[model samples]
Target: MKITGIETFCLRYRMPYALTYPRGEYQEREAVLVKVHTDDPNIYGWGEAAMWGGPFSTTTTVLEKQLQPLIVGQDPCCPEFLWEKIYQETYYHGRKGILLSCLSGIDIALWDILGKVAGQPLWRLLGGFARPIKAYASSGYYRRDYGLDALAADVGKAKSAGYRGYKMKVGNLGAAVHSRVLHETPLRVSFQEDIARVEAARQALGPNLDLMCDATTSLDAKTAMAYADEFERIGVRWFEEPTQPENISGCAELARRTRIPIAGFETETNKFNFAALMDAGAIQVVQPDVIQVGGITEARKIAAYAQMRHLTFSSKNYSTAVSLAACINLLYALPNADFFECDADPSPWREEFLKSPLFTFDDGIVQPFDRPGLGLDIDEVALSQWVVQP
Candidate 1:
């Protein structure tokens, strides 16, 4: 069926308690979701553009002004053609960031449409490698009053919830400079406190489960190397984004020097950049957000590349439920799918986005969804309050 129109919604979920990473303090979660309408009244697909990189209006504006114009009459079934068409037209001005993220929403919607039309689930539609994909609980953002005791409690919760692993933050050391962007007035957690947090988590998790740390790109190569030494000593499974994503050599150095697997560049938008990171031996685990990296179409390319290189491929989780489902769908069909990020945060976004949970968890592993499309049946009521007019 031909595309008829597109609807955009900017959603903002205010957090009860604010959380801090290495770069910024976030008080709310924001996303731009798009609904693609087709010629038939019966068919439509949902998509989302994450708002962590830029303003929410920027993404929605691009959807309404730029992408919708070209996509209005095109067939949503041909996601591949539309993806390239949009990329080629916008590459001059929109190679990465908000532009590609907008494209990603539409691309995901197009795939959802294709899956519905074909009467197959997205994972099966893409490749259908295997059903169950491994998952790691992703949370532990720094917050006021959340000490090692609170950290241990969260770890225990994840373990009790049947998660195989849990990932926590690590930029508390003095002037934790994680990303290359260089934010002013960064927060600090001393080395002693940081180690205490990991040790607490390990104690709570016991010996069987996994524990990964995200440096939030807080440290440089030298600092991260020293920090990683301590992490390895604590039996930490992986060290994620220890330094700035753009520092290819620094990342390469960490991978070369450290025994812990270096995972990163979730902020990254393209596969070629991923190739550069891979080529440099920078990361042992490749992490790209499906929403940020041009949707499933581009994500698959990265996964394939990671597989070829014999590295772990895991989608950076922490977006809307639609993004979470999209990542799972893509990962289930990939050979090197290592850790699917099961957002362990207590946000109302994921479960409320859809009418019901799309996938099931078996002891922290995500079971494949066999329903048509991305298995996203949008719950408009649940989304209504978060909708932003501006």
Candidate 2:
């Protein structure tokens, strides 16, 4: 069947709690959702993408105005071709960032529609790899936001909630305090540490905690190596984003210097970008976000690629339960599935937006469902209520 129309929704929701990162704090979250309609009876598909680079680069606006128009009358099953067309056409103006994020959502939604039309799940259509990916509790705390004791308590909260693995903020705190604070949590606690604090955290946490660090594209190749030397002592499981995402060469060099595996690609737009990161020998673990990285279509492909390379593949999650449900369905389809990220912040609305929420445990595991499509029904009314009119 051919495409009929595409509609866009800008959603804004005030968070019950704030989400703080080293970069900034978010009290409210904003994103755009796409609904693609087809000529076949009552079939439709849904997708979500980032609406960033406002004014200068209207990602969703361009997608709704230009890209969506181009694909309106085209075949819904032509995701690859349509994606390539959008890429080539928008290459001069939109190769990376917001443009790609918009394309990602639409492309993902199209795949979901294709799966529904075929009477199959998105994972099955994408070559069902595995099911029930092990998940980690992504503790919602930052150095600036919570005191060391409070951060430790949050980590404890995640452990008590049945999360087996957990990740916490780093960079802003001293390595010694970061390590001491993590000791309060019971499970594997990975920190968002910079290269400067690597040695100190290693010394403090010692060998037991599954202590890892994230550089967040903040360090150069040479500087990253200094921390790389301490990996042996710290027994680091992974070193994440030591250099900018585009600096694959630097990532490669850093990986080569340390025995620890380098993890990255959360901000990646497509499988091609992931392939580039892998080719550079810059990554040992591929982290693709369900919403930001083109949904399940591209996520499964990227995971498959990581599997081919015999590398670890982990998916990132920071959205609501609806988005998490979508992620869980795809994670069920991964072969070399690693830990999944569960948004640990206390948000009742996040729960209110979903029909069947994820089953998270103190052991840090989330099981996949036998249900159809994403396994969880979307709350259309709730979606409408949160819609941001523009």
Q: Evaluated with TM-score, which candidate comes out highest?
A: 1
Q: TM-score of each candidate? A: 0.96, 0.82
Q: Write the per-residue lDDT of candidate 2 for residues 25-97, one digit (tens) a residue.
A: 4567666777788998667777767654253237557777878877988999877888778878888877767
Please give, for residues 1-390, the per-residue lDDT of candidate 1 as tens digits.
799989988888888888877777778878788889999888898887766757767777889999899898998999989989999888889878888788889989899999999999998888888757767888888888777888899899989998889999887565566334544434566777778888899999899888999987778799888888898888989999888888999989889988999998888888898999999999999998888888888889988999899998998878788887788888888878888888877577788757777889887778856789988877798789898875
Model 1 weakest 10-residue run by lDDT: 178-187
Judge candidate 2 against the unseen true structure and give its global Cα lDDT, from 0 to 1.
0.66
How high a TM-score does candidate 1 get? 0.96
Taking all chains together, the TM-score of candidate 2 against the true structure is 0.82
Off by over 4 Å in 2: 52-57, 143-145, 173-212, 226-236, 346-350, 358-363
Global lDDT of each model?
0.85, 0.66
Evaluated at residue 329, the lDDT of candidate 2 is 64
Going through the candidates in order, what is the number of backbone clashes in each? 7, 8
